[model samples]
Every structure is written in C-alpha cells, then in structure tokens.
Target: MSTINCFFNTYQRRLEDLEKKLNRDQLLVADELTSAERELAMEMVHMGLLENIAQRVFVTKQFPINDFLLRQLVLGQGVYTGNTALYLWHLSDAFPYTIQLAVRMGYQVPKQRYLEWTENVQFKQVRQPRLEEDVKKIDVAKTTRKILVYSPERVLVELIKSTETDKELLKAGIQRYLRSPQRNLNQLLMVSKRLKAEKKVQFIMETLL
Candidate 1:
C-alpha cells in the first residue's frame, strides 16, 4: 500500500474505535479523554460524528436532542419543574414550549450556554429551604443518563403555588394524576403540608377525586 493510503486507513480505524466508545456511553466528557483522544473527539465534532452540547460535554450524533438530553446538559444547575416536570412524569401529553428549571435563589444560570441548544428556557429561582424538596432522579429512556426533577407530588404543589401557571394546564395535570396508577394521595398530602399549600391542594383533591 502507498504511504498516504496506509496513513488514511490507520486514521479511519482510530476514529471508528473512538466512535464505538462514545456510542456505548451516549455522552463523552472531555475531562475523561486523554490528549490523543481529545484531539480525535474534536475532529469528530467537526465531522458531525459528535456534537458538543455543553461545556466539556459531547454526545453521539445518533442521540436524540429532545428534552431528556437538554435536561442532562443542566443536570447540576437545577431540577426540572413546572410544565417540564409534568411532562417527565407522563402526566401531560403536551410538551412544554418553554423548558422550566428551578434553581436555588442567587444561583447564576448559564443562560447563554443553555440557549445554544434551545431558546425556550426559563429559570425559576426558589428559596434555599424549598429548592431541593422532593427532588428525584428519574431514568431517561434509551439512554444511560438520568435527570433530576421534582416528584409528582411536589410538582402538584408547585402548580398550586405558582400564579404564572395556566389554570387549564393545572386542571389537566391534576385530573391526569388522579387517574394515573402511580397516583399517591398520601404522598401528595404530605408534600402539600410541607409546602404549606394543604388547603389549596385539599380543595382541588376534593373537587377532582
């Protein structure tokens, strides 16, 4: 084989090996790559073999760029809440036009970084005491990653407390939860008590269930 042809074959083999490694995990963390691997990863990014979704985060091109991946990008920054959380719980069929995230008060959101993926992101800052209440890690379908989101009970309480949420969406979410097999009235009431929204929650529960 010619020298140039031999070099090209070796490069293609290296790229294929790297692609297999990234595909197995679905996500590639830049920090985990060695100097040589990092260089190849960047080349892959340029060739459309991978995508640099966030700082130090790259995903294989085969991965879907849906809400799940978007949530993964902001994993440590905040937990998914509001309409977005409702969708995650399968309580609503309508995907939120705006991705709503709840962060602790005074937390600096890297808005520009998130906007690079999608323009419909809203950050809700909550008090320190309430920020982490009832948060849970739920698995994303067809991927190895899990995303942080408010539990169904907590999401219900938030819907009751937030004046910004539409009444129709709130009603729909409540009705869906009431009908779902996973519904837990006890846990719902417990969370309502902690959030000091028991009266409103009870009124809705009484009217619906």
Candidate 2:
C-alpha cells in the first residue's frame, strides 16, 4: 500500500471532499498505492499545473532547478544582494557588500533563509557556500529559502559585533579579518569614515597589506 494508492483505488468518495477537503475524511482511500499509481497521480497533478496550488512543496532545503527555471525564479522574486544580507543580521552600519543577486541556481543549501526576515537578503556566488557560492537554496525554517549572493568577511564582522562588544573582541576581529580572503579593505575604509575607525582600519590595512 502506498500513499497515493487510496485516491485511485476507492470509488465511494465525495467529489467536494476529494477536491476541497484534504483532511483524513477527504476520501475512502485504498489500503495502499503502487509506485506506478503514485507516479500517475504525480503526472496528473503536474500536467494539470495543480502542483503549486494543490500539492504544496514545503521546502526549506535545497533542490534542483535548471537554468531557465533559475532565471525565472530570480527575475520573478526581484531578489537583490549587498544590504540585504547585512539586513538579515540586523546590523546595517557598514557600507553594503554586493556580491550576487538573489535567484535560483538549483543550488544546494545547508539551511534556508528565515521567513519574516527583517530585510531582503542577497548572497555571494561561490564554489562551496559556507566557503562561498554563487547560489544558495536553503530551507530556512518551514519554507524553502534561497540566497544567491554573500560576503563572508562582512558577515563575519557583523556576527562578531553582536554578542562580544568588548574592545578585545573588536581587536580580535580586526586581526582576524585583516587577512581574510573576502575582507573588503575598501568597504572597511568606507565604514571607518562614519564609524571613526580610521586608526583601526589603517592599522589593519597596513598589517594586511
């Protein structure tokens, strides 16, 4: 017996219940459904274009998407990068770090973006994600999420500012980010202008350079 078997196997089903009611009382389902029956049901749903509306795909994890679908998803969502990511962290003091726009790439993400997020998010397109990726399709919470761009260094800087605000924390952050591969010296300098981090920035730039 399979999940979709009951749908095709039984005959005494209320049309309204079958169509509108999705609860257990929806129909007199069969004991089980065969793989063929399951596939057949999927095809019917797919052909009728009822998958999105009727069959909900609760994705919070990564999945595959061809290039065409990728473009369609990205363009449709109006996803952008830079300030979006920092916004997610709730820290926007620094100049934004633009890397990539938010879109689908059939990317495999470890975690999806959070729903009801404070700001729109963008991600960096890289090779390995966490390490860096051009596309991030994560299942954030209960929804399937995606981040097409990212800036590791900047993200690190913001995270460091959250819990540990001690001078030592900032100092350590400065030292660590000084030579970080993704560390944007230019952005850091720009942020230093408003934050009055000239001395700190200069010192780090000098050391890293």
Candidate 3:
C-alpha cells in the first residue's frame, strides 16, 4: 500500500480500538477522557463514528436515546417517577412526552454547561421526608448503566396522589400493573399504606382487579 493508504489504515485501526474502549453503555463523557483521548474522540465525532449529545457527552450510533439514557445524561441525581417510571416498568403503553424526575425537596438540578440539545425534562420535588422510600436502581435496556427509579408499587401510589395525571392513562397503568406477572400486590399495598393512600389504592384495586 502507498504511504498515504498505510497511514489511513493505521489511523482507522486506532479509532476502532478507541471506540471499543468508549463503548461502555455506548456513552462517553468528555471529563472521563484524557487529553489525548479527548483529541481522538473529537476526531471520531468529526468522522460521524460518534455523536456529541451534549457539551461533553458523546454516544455511539447504537446508543438507545430513550428517557432512561437522557435522565442519566442530564439529571444524574434524581429518580425516574410518575409517567416516566410507569413506562419504564412496562405498566403503560404510552411513552411520556417529557421525562419526569423526582429529586429531594432541597436538591438543585445540575446546570448543563455543555448541553447543545434541548430536552423536555420535568423535575418534581419529593417532599416526603423519606425520599428514597421505594427507589431502586435498574439497568437501562441495551446499556450497562443502571438508573434510579421508583418501583412499580411506588409509582402506582404516586399516580393516586397526582391530581393532574390523565385519568385514562392512570386507569391503563393500574390495569397493566395488576395483570403483570411481576406484580407484587403486597408490596403495592405496603407502599400505599406508607404514603397514606391505602384506601384509594384499595378502592382502585377493588374496582379494577
């Protein structure tokens, strides 16, 4: 091969190796890269081998850009709740238009200094003293990253408390949860009792199941 062809081949190999190293969950943050690796990453971005999702965030072409991944990228400190959590647990067929996140009452959302794209993310403050009551970490599908989210039982209770939620969607979510093989009726009741929604939850269950 000519010297130019040889150089191109070698460069291509290096990029491939770098891609492999950065493909963990198919997501990369600029801060995680060393100076030299940052240069290579930018080159990969230029070549369309990777995409710059935010200021310092890069994702491979295969990255699943869903609510879960977006939550991890932007609101790293909150748990998915409400409709977003319902969708994640497969209790609802409708995908949430905006990502719903729950954070501690006093928590401040991190400022996205480098986010180049706009995401419609809604953050709700969990005013309950025990904010982590039903929170759990779950693996994002097709990625190694585990995201914090409210358990299905907790989500059901939340739906009961929310006055603004769509009635049809709420009914659908409850029905789906009741029919799911993974449904834990005991857990659902426990969460509802703790949240002081036991009566409402029981009524919904009696009406539906």
Supply every candidate's count of residue pairs whose N, Cα or C atoms clash at under 3 angstroms. Answer: 0, 20, 1
Identify the runs in model 3 with alpha carbons over 4 angstroms from their true place: 1-18, 34-36, 109-119, 127-129
Candidate 3, TM-score vs. the true structure?
A: 0.77
Q: Judging by TM-score, tell me the better candidate of 1 and 2.
A: 1
CA lDDT scores, all candidates in order: 0.80, 0.38, 0.78
Q: Give the alpha carbon lDDT tens digit for every residue of 102-139 in model 1.
A: 87898776666666543566888999778877888887
- lDDT tens digits by residue: candidate 3, 91-127: 8888888878878798765556523222576768877
Among the numbered candidates, top lDDT falls to 1
Give the distance in Å from residue 111's predicted Cα in candidate 2 to where it truly belongs.
Answer: 21
| Model 2 stretches with alpha carbons more than 4 Å out | 1-57, 60-164, 194-196, 203-209
Candidate 1: residue pairs that collide: none
TM-score of 2: 0.27
RMSD of 3: 5.0
Error of 1 at 145 (Å): 0.2
User: Which run of 10 residues does model 2 get worst, by summed lDDT?
Assistant: 52-61
